[model samples]
Target: MQIRDLPYTDPGDPDVRSGPRFLIWLGRNQIRGQLKSLSWGLLHQCSIAGLPLVIGFAVQAVVDRSGNRLALSGGLIAVLGVLIAVGDTMLHRTAITNWITAAARVQQLLARKTAELGSALTRQVAAGEVVAVSTGDVEKIGWFVEALSRFAAAAVALVIICVGLVVYLPSLGVLVALAMPVLALGVLPFLPRATRRADFQREKAGKATELASDTVAGLRVLRGIGGEELFLGRYRRASQEVRKAAVRSAQMWSLISAIQVLLPGVLLISLVTYGAALARDGKIDVGQLVTVYSAATLLLFPLRHVEEIAMAYSFSRPSAQRAVRVLSLSRVARPSTVDAAPTGDLYDPATGLMAPEGLFTAVVCGDPDEAGRLADRLGGHAQPAVSQEGAVEEGATDHEVPSVLLGGVPLDELELDAARTAVLVQDKDPVLLSGTLRELLDVPSSGRVTAEDALSAAQCDDVLNALAQASVDSGGDPMDTRITERGRSLSGGQRQRLALARSLVTDPEALVLDEPTSAVDSHTEARVAAGIKALRKNRTTVAFASSPLLLDLADRVALVHRGTVVAVGTHRELLRGEPRYRAVVTRETDDEIPAPAPPGKDEAIHAIDTIEEIEERA
Candidate 1:
């Protein structure tokens, strides 16, 4: 949030929009700031032109009256100097603040847009491109928008100075006017090449960043396979590519700089030579000659900058285009029947998986991949939307299913907050936040359950004791002890149990947990299952687990084969009915358990109880 720490927002001209167009966008949004900046720029430009004129007038006056008018002209010249100094300082401050705030606002807008699109943002664009756009491109865009105001005012002042000279000394004025167009338009020849080089540089930079990110994420696997050097080589190649692209961009920019500097030098010589001739011919007065020379001299300082600005524009335009592209991405999550009236218990009619109200459902996917995919769907992580995302690789061919629903409604149909409330998925990764035990259980919000309550329910009394115990490692009570990044300090089971406990605290309507006790031993896994069962009570709970202990605890188990549910029954039932289900559930022990019972027994008994209850009421 600190402005000083942020990357430079004013990308100095590598911005994509034309200077005028950028001003138009800024004027549309921050009209007040734009106008204020414009006002300051105008004043600053006026000071430059005015100072020269005042000097020209004072010199003429001294020559004309010998010394009689000297005092008045000298005082007027002093006033002009003071105004120029004061105006220049104030305008400089105003221009800087204007750019800083404008860049900040554009960054805010990009962040807001990213949040709206969420995961879909990357799916709509290359992930590397999104990273580059948010960082580099957004800043470039704001830079151009800020620079446009001053550029516009400077341009107008240049024109005004040219016209004034034409009237006072026509010959000198016309030559100076001719130089401005050549400076502005002559650079057109080199801009295309410059833009092409800029695009290449940006593209290479994105690749380098992507390679770096991917390598870091896969360091563990790479180290295991002894492929660290292979990846390092890849990154090295990417870095080299980036270096080459940068050199090309710099070369083109250098060429543009040469033209900006060299051409203006040529123009200055011609103007000075022509002006002196007019002065020697006695056609133009000495005062006019001084004014003409001053304008031409001052003109080059601004005019040469035009070439630098042209190259800056070329450098920044691609970044702006990328940023604009990212901002333009549409959000996913289409409107559905769930929006009309939320269907209570979770339902997936397509896959024939249903957890009716107040049921302890265990899914037994014949394929481990299918089980995990179904878990994500049940958890509302995957759903049909205007946009689609690539599968989050969970290892080995276990891809995400197309549709997962709650009640009759597709989980994706619900808004994000609503979906989180309805179904909570504890991803395989045990996310350990940096906070006290109470805060970790809290999941960051109001209405959070107390740490003591969630811990007791999770059977974390021992965990708190361990945390509270003082040893060579000492920080605070286990309950108060902060978890390290990714909870690297904690054991795998500790991390998993803590994550499961956090989800339990949310107490969502339907909970979908993926191997909540995978890291724990048999005894701990059994305890977690019992604790989870006791805590769920009336709420629907769906778990994707192959552990026999957790499987035995399920009221009913469904077998998911491939991307669809193959069978629905208790854990024992699936073992007997489906070989694949039995094989997955008892991979360690090939022996299978018999079916527990037919689902009809519970249904038939429920019907009888309903009839008897009605009779009792009558």
Candidate 2:
């Protein structure tokens, strides 16, 4: 496809069997563009090669003192120059277009794969590796793709020059033909070493990048724990390692480059020296000597292209392999053939937990970690559980784990889009992408709730006020305030509320929220809980929280202990009837017994006291 047509509507299914195969697949897909680039490149190189011959004829004409031959040679020079200019310009344009379009296609494929895998992609691949592949590796792969046509044109031009010399003056022509191969092949022996060093450097760089990303993401937490220096030291070591690897890699490539320059220079010097002897011996004239010298000199240019092709492949082969690894990752072996979308209660057979349709359910787990896992499982993206010995737990493999079902159909059995539309799970820490507030909130939604209504239901008046104040100097609207990456500029509580508002706007059939108010104060948490209950009235919602403020608002509460639901009833009933549930929710000890207050009275008093403390602090 042409550059203008890029950003392919579909990048098409890639052959990811191996790195070489993947590179070949990319080439085959862009054959039209490659061929166009090749044609221009051939014209450009051929015109350059023709210049030396035309100049040789001009020299001959001057020696013969023939005005007609001189004039014709001058005309040929002008024509060749024009062809050179046009061919070079178009060749460059087409080659660059090939490069940019190839990179775009790879990026599009990476983005599509990322979307398909979702959170599981990061779990399978290192965040640093993903960053490296999508950014630096993409350019390397594109370089090789664009270099292919140029290299081919250069090779063909070299062949033509050699053949012309052999036919015109066999003595020097044979030497040139034989030595060209030597100059070209001399660098091959060093390529493997250079390639290894390059791969090592890339690996080191990826680790360093990943470390830096993680360090920056947790900089606040690291400072709070007085461990920022420790991470900084580790990162410093990683950076040093990357530097060392890069230097070693550069040293090897420098050796190859030296050989490329040295061999060609030697050949040129030999040809000029030998041709001068032929002219002195009366075997060939001054014009023939000049032609021999010029051909040898011009041959150096195409020889460099040969080295470039080698270098390009060395760098890009590993990059293509990395890309292949990432693209090969599949959340499922195959797409679900079942087109029917299921609806009803969300049920996890593994946990024996059922969140009935059109009801608000709260799950209380003795282990908060388990609650998070349950949330993922309910959304059909469950990760394998690791045993204490660091091995994957049996029967918890991705393919083996029991699927969560809705209306008797397995969630994983339905098309991905259909399943995602039916259920939405917001984990404890939902990231806020960097953009204006309006852009951040403009997600796919059911249109049942407006952005303003969702924001109000999320009790985001303070957040709006803060954003407006921040944007006042810029004279922009409150909704136009730009958030920092991952919403790092906002307080944790503000970020949580905004994420909640976004989720509310989506208005999914089943919404699962994990500790949505974990970062907020009791007063705000209470309002958020009440708002959620009111807004989600007659909709299916599952909230995994232990706060009495949130639990009291649940239509029903399920108590989970040791990975299975043990009790299901109203919050107050479970609190009174199940000791384990009470201990988990209240942080009470089994040995402690106290006089009970009136039913639901304790919760009301607790909520009132928490609100009073929050107001006093404010």
Candidate 3:
């Protein structure tokens, strides 16, 4: 496909066996573009190489003092100049096309992989590493890909120049040919060291990037805990490490550049001195001496391309390797045997938790972490076995069959799309993508609920007002106002309510919500809980929450202690009969003993309750 047809409808599956292999695969896929670039590069470099020859002919004509010969030489020089301008311009255009297309293809592939893996990708790879791969690493790989053809064209032109010089002036030509190879190959020994230093720099930079990403994501929480300075210091150290590594890498590349310059200068000096001596002794004419000098000087241009090729490879190899590492990752592959989506109660065998169909079931976990894990399992998202270093361990497998089942059939046995349609899980930390408020809520849905209805049910009228006020200067509708990335521009409660509205719009068969109202105050939580119950009426719903405001509205509440359900009953029934369940839901600890209150403490508590009751009645 051409560059204009970018963002391929499908960036074909990449060969991810190794870094070099991945690069080779990329090259093979874009062979047509590479060849086009190579052709243009050849025209450009060949035209440049022909310049010294034309200059020599002009010099010879001047020496002969023939007007006819001088005119012919000048005409030839003009022709070569035109060819040079045309070739160079086209070469640049084609080369840039190749670079952009290659990078775009890789980005498309990464995006596809990310969609397929979902949240599991971050669990298996560092967020920073993925960012590095898609951004900086992608550019490096593209640089190497585009450089390959140009390097080939330069090498070919160098060969042609050496051959032409040998035939035209053998004495100097022999020296030129011999020294050119040394100039080209002189920096080979230092490449390994340079590559290592570059790799080190890239690693440090990636770590720093990951740290920065994490810091920004949690900046609000850090400030709340007064730990922002602590993290800033850590990031400062990481940034310094990156700077030091970069300096080391730069020092090596600088040394190589010096060698390239020094060797070529020496060759030019020797050729000029020797050729001048020959001309003085009348061994060769002045025009022949001029040709040798010009040829030696022009050769340096192509030799610089040789140095560029080395530098590109040194930087891109590691980048390609990192890209391959991310591409090679696979999620827990489950066999798909069932064709149709199953319907019935959702069951998690591992936790012995069941959510009966057509009911609102509230789950209260003694530990919040366990609640998140249980929520994942209930939705067929069993955590894969990943190492501390964020890699899948050898022999790791996400059960042969899913631990979660629907209608007595394992969820993993059904097609992925079917399983997702059957159950939708909104995690504790749901992300809101940047877009208009209307677009944010526009997802695949049963169409039972409209966006307006969902927004009202989620008590998002205040959010709407905020968005409208924020967009008043732009003269845009509230629904059209844009959200910042991850909805960071909104308050935490606003983001949560918006996410809930999106999920409600989907109207899935089974909905699992984890801490959906955690960010809201008690008053808002009460309305949200009632709205969810009213909206999800006669549908299967499971909520992993501890708030009594939410639990009081549940049709049935399950108390999960130590990863297993210990009690299942109505909210009031459990609160009165099960002390363990009450302790969990109320967040009460045994460490505190009841003590006599100060005079009027009870009166103060009664006064606050009276105010709340008055507000509720109003």
Task: Give the winner by lDDT.
Answer: 2
lDDT of 1 by residue, 1-618 (tens): 234545544323222233445444654665666667677767767777776676777788877975646677678768767776776676666666666766676676667666555444554566677777667766666666666666766777778878887786777788878777887777789889888988898889988887887787567679889999999999999999999999988898888788877877888788778777877998877887788788777776556546655665775677766665554443433453354325467777558788876888887665666666566667654432232222222222343344566666666666766766777777666568876676787664224445555566666766666667632344656766767666656667777878888888887778888888878877777878988888787778888887778887888887777656778887656655566775676562344443444775765534533322422322
TM-score winner among the candidates?
2
lDDT tens readout by residue for model 2, 1-618: 777887799999998877888899998988988888889988988898888888888898899998999999999999999999999999899888888988999999999988866777777688888999999999999999999989989999999999999998999999999999999999888999999999999888989999998999999999999999999999999999999999999999899999988998889889888888898999998888788778888888888899899988988899999998888776554348677667799999988999999999999998988998899889877745332223443445545667899888888788888877888999899999998999999999889989998898899999999899889454757789998899998999999999999999999989999999999998899999999989999899999998888888899999989999999998777766577877777777767533466686766645544433423422
Query: Residues 1-618, candidate 3, lDDT per residue (tens digit)?
Result: 677797798789898877888899998998988888788888888888877777877888888887888898789889988988998898888888889999999999898777655666776688989999999999999998898888988898889889998999999999999999999999999999999999999999999999999999999889999999999999999999999999999999999999999999999889999998999999998888888788889889889899998998889999999998778865444457898888888888777788999899999998888898788777766547342235664544544534688888887787767877888999899999998898899899989989988898899999999999999444758898999999988999999999999999998889999999999998999999999999999889999998878888899999898977889998777765577875676565664322445676766544533324423432
Candidate 3: where are CA atoms >4 Å away?
281-283, 335-341, 383-403, 474-476, 576-579, 590-618
Model 3, C-alpha of 444: deviation from truth (Å): 2.8
**Judged by lDDT against the true structure, how good is candidate 2?**
0.86
Candidate 2, 134: how far from true, in Å? Answer: 1.2
Clashing pairs in 2: none
Supply every candidate's count of residue pairs whose N, Cα or C atoms clash at under 3 angstroms: 12, 0, 0
